[model samples]
Target chain A: MKIIRSVAEMQKETLMHKENKRSIGFAPTMGYFHKGHLQLIEEAKKENDIVAVSIFVNPLQFGENEDFGRYPRDEKRDIQLAESYGVDLLFIPTVEEMYPTKPQLNMVMVDRVDVLCGKSRPGHFDGVVTVLAKLFHIVQPNRAYFGLKDAQQIAVVDVLIQQYNFPIELIRVPTAREDNGLAMSSRNVYLTEQERAEAPAIIHALQEAKSLMENEERHPAVIVEKVRALLQQHTSAKIDYVELLSYPELKTIEQINQQVIVAVAVQFEKARLIDNIIYHP
Target chain B: MKIIRSVAEMQKETLMHKENKRSIGFAPTMGYFHKGHLQLIEEAKKENDIVAVSIFVNPLQFGENEDFGRYPRDEKRDIQLAESYGVDLLFIPTVEEMYPTKPQLNMVMVDRVDVLCGKSRPGHFDGVVTVLAKLFHIVQPNRAYFGLKDAQQIAVVDVLIQQYNFPIELIRVPTAREDNGLAMSSRNVYLTEQERAEAPAIIHALQEAKSLMENEERHPAVIVEKVRALLQQHTSAKIDYVELLSYPELKTIEQINQQVIVAVAVQFEKARLIDNIIYHP
Candidate 1:
């Protein structure tokens, strides 16, 4: 595996591969490598001649009060894990390298992005979209991998691709999870022992809601209330949002007549955790 | 010269040229091919192994009262003119073909974008950026060409390229002008016989300001007053804005020490025209 740092070098390498008629698959992440990230790389390896992964802790996605400063970083562990998965290129760009100018460009402006996680952390989606846009242009992948864990992000990115007509096929892998159904997230390391014990409640609530929907209990309001009650069992748990939205659009639906997604976000004593489940009725 | 309508076809053709390790230069414009548009293509052909031009009359850049509905378009004339310059590929995508969806994505959310033309035409820059983003992706040119006539647009696009870290170099071609110094624009067709007669005043004012700056006039207010006085000579012209700003940032500068841009917008009987001159002191 090649460890590339400069955007110009990466572009040159990718263009060579393109000249040889090789399809490059890209996996972008804020590297604290896990099974979920490896799964994305594995999938990319199967579909393309070369795989590229970017690991930059995007500061734009975190608000002033959020964990931008405290976000974890481990280059050694990440490099070993990525090479093990047969990554062709591992991009590690500094903030200055990626953004020479203070990125005054708001490239990821989308409609309805202001809802869901956007409502709580304003400009978070903008940051994600901006970084993703930069990565997309840098890598010029035939297909890009994004985990369904950030379900709202996938929706916003979908619009970004369609609106900008980026020549990329966005392959959304299913949400990777832990043994107890807690979605795999880098922030999961922040959970204290007690908070970790209660973290499963968030996933449990999602499972219960999906089960209820599958069994013909479809009132979105009732499901939201029940999920809120379940999370209330944890004393330190603070609900950010508990929504049962139409799949992909993230809009509210009274009943699940078509594809639907049940998603949740909560702030515990340790860190914020988000997870989701999609179902068809 | 090849005329292509489908993005897939163009991409395939471009890929073949890429396999030869040929550099691509692109020029994106709205149709009604004038000498200015032809000059860009001619310059691109000299610099690149492949020169691609996309003519799209983006509806997103048009205001409610703007001339989007009546904008001049002539594909036959455009193709004939492009052929004269030995163009590689001419991309003329239909509106339905360009926008398969309503484009739920808004690309122009840049700070200070709303100051000049952005303020006059709400969401105009958003559309411009959105369409340009699409074109950038589809054409995937090594160096993209933009004219200095749309000075504000060039600044915005420069930010777009920088902010997104798009792997393409931007070349700002000097503004092509008429013998009378009127900046070439497709919208010049909207000028009536009387409006066309008085149109040279706009350029005259810019020239007067340029002369003042050349003679070391440093005060912005004085320069603006001189330009405004020159503009007052045209009985049919209604001045919209006249200001001296720092280049790219568009911030008002009290004194010109470095590069500065003098810009003006005027409404004639049936059309609004914008022109600018960049001066370095």
Candidate 2:
């Protein structure tokens, strides 16, 4: 992997690749390399002539109380993993470089928010789209890889691509998870021994919700209540929210005849864990 | 010039040109085939392998009370003018085709919008940026052309291209003017014989301000007052706004040591005319 830091250099490299007709696949991350990160890189390498990975811990996405500072970092190990997965370009822009001044263009998310993680973290997805817009222009990838772990991000990004007419495809990869169904995340390291024991139940609750939907349970409220009850029974953590909303649209459905997501957020002692299952009925 | 209305076809055509290393110069306008529009196309042709012009009277940029419905368009003549200027592609997306549904991505301008036309027409620059974001993605130009008559648009667009890191260069073409010194615009067709006679004085006011600045006059308010007095004495139009501010930043200057702009908007009997002069000290 070739380490790159400046935005201008990255854009020049990508533009040269574009002129040569090489398909570049981009995998964007916040860098504490894990299985989920590697999976995205692996998928990008499989489908493109060049694989580009960006690892900037975007400060814009975090709220005042959220973990912007000390989110996570492992540059040495991240470089090793990226090189192992054959990443052609590794972008590591510092905060000063990425945002030399306050950006004049302000972006906001108008849809597919007001639910999931977005409900609690206002302006989170706005920050997300803002950064992604800059990155999309910088990298100019043929296709971009995103894991379905944060299902809402994928849906919002779909709108960004379609509405903005970005000449890039969004490849949705299934969420990389541990053997116990715990979604792989950098924040997973923050869980204490007791909280870690309870973390598996978040995914378990979502699985049950999906099973109930599969077996003809159609009432969204009923499913939500049941998932809340299951999580309450299994985990000592506080239940943040349990929702059954239509996929991508994230709207409350009276009849679950379309694709829906059963998502949950749990507040552990040290971290907030989120999990979801997209059900096709 | 080939006329394309479909977004998909335009993207495919532009993408093919992009891959083949053909430099695309985009000239976007709300068409009525004026000399100003032709001048932009002519300049675009000079700089790139392919010249693409889009005639979209973007509804997003117009206020509820603005002239969106009454916006002048002449497709036959506009097409002929583009072809006459050696344009390669002409994209004419209908309002419905451009906006198939409400866009999920929302953009807001946080800087350089509180003065000039942006202040009078709230949400105008936001919508301008939104449509341009879509058009920029679809056209993927090597350079985009804009007339300096709407100098604020050029300034805001400067922020857009810079902050978004768009790979396209912004070519600022000097304002095309009539023989009588009136800035050329399709909206000039709305002017009556008397209003048309009065329009040239707007440009005369800006020229006077430039001369004042050239003669070591530095107070922004002094230049603004002189321009306003000149316009009042020369024409019967209602002066919408008359101000002088720092260039691009659009911020008030205590002293004119930097490049500055003297802008004026006059509401004629039937049309609102805007013009500006960017003066370098």
Candidate 3:
């Protein structure tokens, strides 16, 4: 597989590929790959003549107080995983390589922002929109894959794509999970052994909420309180928020007659764990 | 030349062109094509395998009180002008075609925006950035031609392209002017016969400032005063602003030792005219 870094070099490669009439499918990610990311690459490879994956741990997306410094990264391991999925190119751009100079803000984010993860992490969606716009320009892919794990991100990206009229199709893969039902995340690596043991509770709470939702229990407040109580049982876990929101718009659901996402974020011993389940009533 | 109205169709056409190994040079304009806009298309035709011109009189860039309703537009005239310049494609998207849904309040605007035309016309730069970004994505040009007549706009576009890592080379064609030296503008249609006759004074003031700087007259305040006095003499012209600013960065230049732009804005009859001259001291 060809490993490219510079945007110009990637554009040149893309131009040649286009000249040869090769269809391109792209999977954009922040490195430290796992089964979740590999699945995306595999899916991309299935649909296009050439599959390219970009590993950019975007600094702009991280909040000032967030875990940007310790975000897990292993380029060697990421490349090995991506190549195994028959990826044709691995785009590994350095922070300076991706952003040679201090860039002017070019993209305008939508208002309301779905306000999911954006509530705790302000300007996060702005960062995501900015970087994704840049990537779309460079890759010029026929289709791009994104994990449903970042449900809020997918919603934001979808709106941006439609609003800006970017020539890309978004293909969302289901959120990959561990055997114990915990959603797989690069940040999960930051949890201490004890915290790791308690992390599964996030998923457990989501499942419990889904079961309650399925039983025709429609009170959003009641569902939230139960999830909050269950999460509070773990001494290491502190509930950041447990709320029921409209699936994609993420607005408050006055009545749970439509699709909804019951999501939870809990602070563990050394990290924050987030998980969610979608249900229709 | 083929005229494309829908963004989807334009993207498809662009993709088909790419697959055929065509290097597209684009000229994005707010219709009512003047000599300046035609020059950009001429440049595009000379440099590219295919030339695409988009004539969109974007509403997003105009303030509520500004002349959005009266913004001149003649698609037939523009198409003829574009075809004369050997343009391969003419993209004429209606407001509904471009924006099916109303845009959110959030938008992109450069930091140094409130210096020239930006200050006079509120939210103008944001509109320019938003529409240009959308056009760039839809057109996906190899190189985009911009007339240097709108000096600050050129700077804003330059910064945005760099920030977004758009795969485009910005070719700044020198500002095209009329025989009497007034910078050609779509708003020129609003000028009355008497107002139009006196409009050349705007260019004359700029030229005088350039001459003074060339002769070692370094005081920016003096230059500002002289230009203001020249425009004030024209009874029909209401001087909006006259200032000497550093080129590109657009910082207020107290002493003209480097490259500087003498920009002026005047309101005559119902039209607002802006023009500038770059001088090196």
Going through the candidates in order, state the TM-score of chain A alone for each one: 0.96, 0.98, 0.95
DockQ for candidate 3, please give it: 0.61
Cα displacement (angstroms), candidate 2, residue A140, comes to 0.4
Instruction: Grade the docking of candidate 1.
Output: medium
Per residue, candidate 2 scores C-alpha lDDT tens digits across A37-98 of 88998899899999999999999999999998979888999899888888999999998887
Writing each residue's lDDT as its tens digit, candidate 3 over B78-197 gives 888887878888899999988888774245675758788989887898888888888988898989999888888998888888877788899999989999988999999988999889
Off by over 4 Å in 1: A112-115, A229-236, B7-16, B109-116
Give the candidate number with the greatest TM-score.
2
Global lDDT scores for all candidate models:
0.85, 0.91, 0.84
Report the C-alpha lDDT of model 2 over B1-281, residue by residue, as the tens digit.
78999999999999999999999999988889888888888888888999999989999999999999998878898888778878889999998988888877889999999998999999999999999999999999999999999899999999999988899899999999999999998889999998898889998888888898889998998988998998899898999999888998999889999988999998887799999999889
i-RMS for every candidate (Å) is 2.5, 0.9, 2.4
Put down candidate 3 lDDT per residue, A97-122, tens digits, no spaces: 77887655545566646465778888
lDDT over C-alpha atoms for residue B140 of model 2: 97
Worst 10 residues of 3 chain B by lDDT: B103-112
DockQ scores of the candidates: 0.63, 0.87, 0.61
Candidate 1 CA-lDDT value: 0.85
User: What is the Å distance of residue B27 in model 3 from its true position?
Assistant: 1.7
Cα misplacement distance, residue B260 of candidate 3 (Å): 2.2
Candidate 2 local Cα displacement, residue A91, angstroms: 0.6
